[model samples]
Each structure stands twice: as C-alpha cells, then as structure tokens.
Target: MKCKILPPKVLYHPVLPYKQLTSDNTHKLLFGLCRTCMNKISFKCKHIDDPTLNKHDKIHEIKRCKECKNIKNEKCIHSNEERVIVGTWSTIEIDKAIEKGYKLQKIYELEHFEKTSTDIFKLYVDTFMKYKQEASGCKCDPKYCKPDCENDKECKTKIQYIIDNAAYNLDIDKVKHNSGLRFIAKICLNNLWGHFGMRDNFTQKEYCFTLEHITKIVFNEKYKDISTMILDENIVLTEYKEKEEYSKPNPSVNVYIALFTTAHARLKLYELLDILQERVLYMDTDSCIYNDDGSEACKK
Candidate 1:
C-alpha cells in the first residue's frame, strides 16, 4: 500500500510524563502514562572536575568507581559526590512537575541525556521525500515529471523515457504476483525497522587457559558487568559486557526512526479502527480482523 504520511523529524524523549493514568485525566496526553519506570542507571565520578584526574579513563565500578577510589585525597571523595541514579524524563514531564509545585532539588546533578532539537533524521526524510517527488512530479520543476505525476501532459511527457525504467518506479504488480519478490520486499521492510532499533551491547564470551588471559579479562576496569565459569582446572569461560564508550554502537541504530515508524503505523491502525468502530474484533501491528457486514467496509 502507498503511504504519504511521515512522522515528525524530532520527538521528545521516549519516557512518558507520568507513572500512572486515571479516569480524571485519561486524555491528558496522547498516550497513557507509562505504568513502569524506565530509569537508566549510570555512574559519575567525584573528581570529574579535577584537572589532574584522567577524565578519559573513568571506569564504572560497583561500590566505588575505580578511578576516584584509587586517588589518595584528604577526604573520602567518592562519599561526598552525589552518586545518584536519575530517571530520564521528557521535557514535558519536567515542566509539568515544576508547574505542579514539585520543587526540583539538586538540579545541578541533572545532565542533558539527549538533544531535544537536532535534525538527526533530516537526511533520511529528505532522501525519501526527494524520491517520492521524483516518482511523482515536482510542483515547480517539470523536467523530472513521471507518468504517475498529477501534472499536465507537457510535464508528464518530458520524462517519459524513464517512466518505468527508473529505480524509483517499483513494479508493485510484479511484486504482488511473485511470492519470492513479496517475501524479499517484506523482509527488507522489516529489516529496515529492526536494524535501526538494534541493541548496542551484548555479553561476549571468552575462553582462556592461561592465568594471564583470565586475569586480563576478570580485572579489566572497563568491563563493569563480568562473570566467569570454571569448566575445569585448566579451562575458564568468561562472559563480559563492554562499557558504553568501549561498546560498538550500530551506526544506523536511531531510536527516533524506529519510534516514528511504529508511531505512524499505530496512527494508521487507529484510523482503520475508527472507521470500523465496534466491528473491529481483533488487531495486531500489521493485521486487522473486522466483521464485514456485506457492505462497502471490506471493499474500502
């Protein structure tokens, strides 16, 4: 099916504004407030401002981060630092909380987790919109007109040579008839969404026989999450997770894209349900089951 709707280029942070929803304010927000907490746990160093501290080599540890603990300070520096686990909330939530007279204490501890105003998906939207316009016709530019263009005959015939030849003009009829083509197209669509939302870190396994190899992995300050299993006296299997900085994040994994894709899908689904009303018996992400009362409902 052809889709013309596109989601916003920028979006608020994924977290909901409130924890729970009630009948008094069911429609206060677009979606219901998240019932569960999505707090991200992170470690900060006390000597972050210290000029002598190796800021680049800060390692997160369980009780006390390794970098600050090793330093011989006059006082227990780590104890004085506000080592806090803060919840990442959307700007709307923060503002609402403040408006409701909830005093935000320790405001200095807050850090910007993500950019609120960035054209991160601008290139992606521009590329797709360009193709859409070319496959149709530019409102001002007539030289690149296509057969599917809603422009005049003069403009349509201008680019008649590449009407069906261009890569943008996909043969939907061929794909619909051919099972292989349909499968490939479906997989490609799903892969695009999944690829963008791919997880960055995964626990990796390492098998070592030497004490040096085992010690190197076990005592590495960079890897905060580590576990080891002694298969035998000579064999040791180590599973460890690399810190965010050390981890290789997927270049294309943008949460904004994935969120928009799903958001648009949900909106489309809701549109259909609104039309069907009580007829909608069941529905899923990509499938719908509604009662057809021998009318234009099914035809539509």
Candidate 2:
C-alpha cells in the first residue's frame, strides 16, 4: 500500500449582508462584521473535514467595528428653541427702603438711584450741610491768632479792625438775611411730597411766585421777575399767521406753563384725579365693577 498525503486546503473569504450566516461542513469557519458598512464576513479555515478542530480557530473579535467609528465623526445640530434660557428679576432693595419710611424720597430715588451710586441719606446730609453753611455765613475756617501782641500797635490795630469787621458782619442786626432754614425745609417737603405723587392746585402765576419766593429765600438773592421770565417779543409766537391776521391760538400756552412748573403740575393733576376717584368710591362697596368673586357688581 502507498502512503497518502493531503494537499494544502484552500481558504475562502465570503462577504454577506448584515445578519447573514454561512454553514459549511467541509471547512472550519470564523465570522466578523464591519462596523462602518455593517457587512458580515466569514473566513474559512484550512482544516476541512476535520471533526476535532480547535475552538479558538472559529472565533474572531472586533473591539470597535468601522461603522461605529464613522458615526463619531458626524456633527450633531440642536434646535435653537431647545437652547438654555437666562432671565433676571428686579432687585428688592427699593421695596425694603420704601418699607423703612422713605416712601416720599423712594419715588425719585427709585427713578434715579440706578443712574447714580449715591443714596438718599447722603443727599439729605449734603443738602442740610450746604444750607447750614449758607445760613451761618461762616467761612468754615478757624480764626487767625496773633503772637507778641503787646509791643506791636499795627498788630493790635489789625486785630481791632478784624474784630469790628467780624462783629458787624456776623451780627444779625447788620446783616440782611432771608429765611433760609424755612426755605430749605419747604423745598425738602415739596420734593418729598412731589415724589410721593401729591397734587398741587396752584395756578401758573401762583406756582411760579411760590417757587421764586422759595428760591429767593434759599439763596438770599432775587431772580428775574416773572414777566421777564416769559418769552420775549423777539421770539415769534406764531410764524404761520399772516401779518394782517390775528395770531392763531397757541396750544402750547398751558404746555409751556406746565413745563416751566417742572412737570410737577401735571403730576399733581393726575394725583388730584386719583384722589377724587378714591373719594368718590369711598364707603361705596358696590361701585367696584370687578368684585372678589370675579363677577360684575351693580354700580352704586
């Protein structure tokens, strides 16, 4: 008998669709799938028709298939509507200030406080000090002293002269003074009331006169007369009117008065209306159209 020799077995590699399987009894097989293309692949082992093939010979493991790696390269876009939102709330410091008896000043303070770092108490202190200095007429400086006064007639004479001048100038009798303290007090009170939305009923003339009086008292000086304060003839009242025709009525007459009054007049008008509304509704429960039950109530 002649000895038989087996020829080298040919290896076959097959590619299939994803999830496909291959079965062949003639060859040992190994399987793998590409992550990129998700394609199934099989490798045939050279040991064909061998019943005792090694278990490790049929195993193939991939850490990450090529398909998954490609997914990592693509960028993900998110909708703008789904983006995070940021918001802010008003600070409560002003509310606290109002609760602490600053209701009057709080109005203007709230209006202008954010624009400036200074507080209401600081403004009060400064105004008080300024008015005090103006009232006292003192230079706010210490008086100069003389040394070796016994032998110097010139020094003595100078000292006497200074004393006379100081006495005459500082005396209430010789110095013409206005009511500064009262004026400042009035200004502070008016400003506070105005901030609190109080209404003024004074006519334009009366209002201007009151303001001018307060100003004169505070600064101890006279301002221009109200007549002079009015617009001069050089400023044309109405250009649209013909030379032969009477001037058209100026709608800005009252507007100019209100402006000169520094908007306090208009604010006062609103405040008066508010007061009237409150007074008219006082003790009349049925006057409120919207009731607590969310139904319209009979007007009283």
Candidate 3:
C-alpha cells in the first residue's frame, strides 16, 4: 500500500499477518499457498488505562500494563492495557475479531495496492530454469544414442550436468529422487528476499596486535558498540558496527521489496485459511494443515 505516514505520530514494524493465527487445536487440512498483499493501516483504540483522556486522542495512545509493564498481554487483554495493531488484516477478519471481542479497535480504510513486475530474480530464476531443462534432456537409455552414449559431454548425467552448469549445493541422494531440483527452486524462490533485505550495519571484526591499532579502532568516531577480547599479551580481537551516518548502503538491500513479497505471500495463505476455516489443524509460513471431508475444498 502507498500512503504517507506522519512521523512521531506513526511508527512502523515489519511483521507477517500469518503469525497472528491461533495455535489452538481447531485447525484441519494441510495445504500450501503462494502470493502477497501490500497495505498500511491505522487503527483506533480498544482498551485504555487512563479514564480522563479525550476519546479521540485516547484512540491513538498505547497503555503500558500496571502488572506487567507491557502494552500487551498475550494471554488476555487486561482492562488497563491498550494497543493498536501495526500490520495488515482483512475486513472480514477484523469484523469477526471485533464480534468476538478481539482487540481490533477501529481500522481505517486503505488507499490502494496493486501488482507490478520487476527483474529482481530474473537472472537467478532463468539460469536455474535453463539448468533444469538441460539436465532433463538426457534420455538415460543407451538405445536412444547412436554409439552407446559413453561420453559424458554428449550425454551428461544429471549430477554432471548441474555441477557443470550451476553452482548449487546439491544432495546426491536427493538428486537421485529429483528433490535436489525442488530444493534449489525453493532457495531461488525464498532466499532472494532475505538477500535483498539483509542488514547492512552488521558487526565487523578486527584483529589487532599493537596498542596503537587497538586505540585507533576503539576511538574511531564512525563506529559504535566497541567490544574487545584479549586473545593474548600481544593480540586483541575487536568487534563493532559502523555508525548509521558512516554505514554504507547495500546495493541489493531494498526493504520494501522484502516486505511486499512476504505481505503478498501472507495474503495468499490467508485466502486458503479462509476457505478451510474450522478445519485448519496446523499452520506454517506458506502452508497449513486442515480436515478434508470430501467437500473438495482442496479443488478450489
């Protein structure tokens, strides 16, 4: 979703909506979904600790609990605690939650969300697809070849073919069972977002052998959270992170891409869960377990 947020008045967090699913024993069929949704929502208040604040302003205020000193109580929403949801939720789901006394409060209308294409994973997906296609070319029959097919170049085995064409961490047994291809496909499908969203300011390490080097690292104005370990009388190990201003931007890191990818995926899973409803038995990031009573819900 595209919308402007007034800073200080609005805070954002990256979270998947599927994580909010209940862990009770009411779930049923095991099914998988793949897709996404993008949204930005603002909610009004539900439970407030203070009784004197104006109603409209109180809606935006989060209350810390007296007993737990937290804004939320997972086991139950106490009379004194209050919070506003910070992620996506469907209109139907919100209504049901409110009907069941869930702390949904009031959800504002979303502006708009739509799909567009990009070349983010084009190279990786295309390369693997080509490798998979070429690997499937060998007929595995000597009769099909004119001279008994002994040359690895002419009739390459799947392992030799992939190893020569792709730099994959292949499992030999799984390759025999054709699962290696699936594993590689899964990595291509999922790991791209993680790579694109990797944190840029990760802790960096330096090994120092002299007091000057140690002092130089410890006193660097561009770094923070300096930690040191004396390896010996002459050796020291130091770890620290570059200050935000000094940190370099990662060329591949685009948090918006990562967020939208997972958001769409959660919406896809939610669609299936809506169909399964009371039959859903278990839940995972991209899949679910539920009951199948010959109703052919899976056909949907």
Candidate 4:
C-alpha cells in the first residue's frame, strides 16, 4: 500500500544546565547528606539553596549537583558504545537458557560479567521497564514516572486530546511502515540541525541516495570485475563507479557515497558476512571471488 510520509519531529536538546545556567553567574551550591548511603550530594544553587542562607543572599537552589547528575548523564552516553560492542545474542541463547530456567541467571550472575556504571545500568533498566510496561498494557506509577508526567486530570485530558487529534490527522499504520518515512525524517532532521545551528549530538545526514540508485548499484553486473581490482592487503576498493556516467541522468540518480575507514570496513565486512550467511559462498579477503566460473568474470 502507498503511504504518505509524515514530517519528522524537530530534534531538540533536552533542557540542560549548560543551556539554562548562563555563564559568569555565581551559583550557590547546597550540600545535602544522602539518607541511604550517607554520601554527600550537592544540589545546584538554583534548585537546592542552603535553607540557613539568607533569603537575600543571592543564592540559587540547584536541583542536583554536577557530581551526581552530570556524571550519570556522561555514563549513560558511554553505555551506548558498550551496548554496540556487546553484540546482541540471538533468541537461541534465551531458548537454551530457558532449559535451565533461573540456573542460567544464577550462573551468569556469579560470573563477573562486565559491569556498567550504576547510572548507566539504572538508565537501561528504566528504559527496559518502560517498554515492558508499555507492551504489557500496564500504567507506570506516578511516583516512579519521569519528570514529564501529566498526572492532573486537566493535563491528562489535554494529552489525550492531543493524541486523539494526532490520530485523527495522520494515518498511524501507514506512518509506521512507509518506506519514504526515513528519507523525510532525514530531511526534516537536517533542516532542524541547520535551523538550530547545533553541531554536536544532533542528527546529520551521513549518506543520502535514492532507492533506485541503491538497487541498481547492488544488482549491477558492471561491478563483476571488482574481484580483480583488489591487488594488495592494505588496499581494497569498497566502492566502484561506472567508467561511463549515465547520460540523461535522473535528478534522483546521484549517489552520495559514505566511505568507511579501514578499521570500520573490516567490521562492516564481518557484519555483512554474518547477514549474507550461506548465500555468500566465497569471499576472498580482498575481493568478492566467486567459485561458480571464470566465464562470468570475462563477460564483464
């Protein structure tokens, strides 16, 4: 079914102290002893000012100290890198583990599995809990909910009203599966990045190309001689361009190549190998060497 892609939501930074707290302004730090760990936690002057300090003392109450909150944020960001490195296990792992039930959890629990920082662990657990709750049709407790909770009847009603309006305005099913949705999202996201002039942590287009061009490149017979082109260990051409560029090229036919460094290329090669499996019968380290026949090589 044909689907119309919706415009992507403008990417915005979460409200942060770096943005909210202006430079050159002295913020009073309020110290508090943690009730549980007895560890000292400092809150920012704006949110947690010392009560003993005079009202006109120009003290700002901080919500949370940089030590507690900022470190947590940093660790959470680092956890993403760790997750990527620890490749996801297939369902087969879980299925096999199920045979032993809680014994598997016990064994793995005792083994010194690489531990993430507490803050990162909490963030992952919270996210998993949220998704589990959502999938199971369970409501999160207000006490445990994130700060952006709409608990009051009016706020809740407003949220539902907005959701209902959005549901009425857009085709939800089509939005979920639309092929052009990612392209539209990329354009919108890049536009937002340009508009806001945010350099770091914001979305950027690494590669952009039409589906027709991608399909042609993937299925093209002209690249069959690519195997002979790879000559040495250090040099492997991951890309190839036709000797003759197309005449009367379609506007959407241009290819924006994303070249990977040597290290990344090795990792990508392995990843592609895993995905292709048995279909990829033979893959020489430097080239795509097929065992079928030398006749196909001469044809190109």
The lDDT for every candidate, in the order shown, is: 0.50, 0.31, 0.53, 0.32
Please give, for residues 21-126, the per-residue lDDT of candidate 1 as tens digits.
3323432232211222111112234544545546354332323545634432222222112212233443444444344333343443333456565566556544
lDDT of 4 by residue, 151-187 (tens): 5455455445544644233322222222244445445
Clashes of 2: 3
Quote each prediction's TM-score: 0.42, 0.15, 0.50, 0.15
Across 1-300, the per-residue lDDT of candidate 3 in tens digits comes to: 221111111112112232232223233221111111111011223456688878665644643323323322223322222223344544443443344344433445553448656765678766665545433334454345433343445554744665466555433333332345646766675677788778899999999999999999999999999999999998999999999999999998977677666656666677787676677788777889878876767667
Better of 2 and 4 by lDDT: 4
Q: Which ranking of candidates, highest lDDT first?
A: 3, 1, 4, 2
TM-score ranking from best candidate downward: 3, 1, 4, 2
Total backbone clashes of candidate 1, pairs 3 or more residues apart or in separate chains: 0
Q: Runs in model 3 with CA error above 4 Å?
A: 1-83, 86-185, 295-299
Q: What digit string (tens of lDDT, one per residue) describes model 2 on residues 81-164?
A: 221111111123222222332222112111113443335446664555445333433222124322233234554454445436
Error of 4 at 228 (Å): 11
How close to the true structure is residue 116 of candidate 2, measured as C-alpha lDDT? 33
| Candidate number achieving the greatest TM-score relative to the actual structure | 3
TM-score of 3: 0.50
Clashing residue pairs, candidate 1? none
- Tell me the alpha-carbon RMSD of every candidate: 19.5, 41.7, 14.4, 31.8
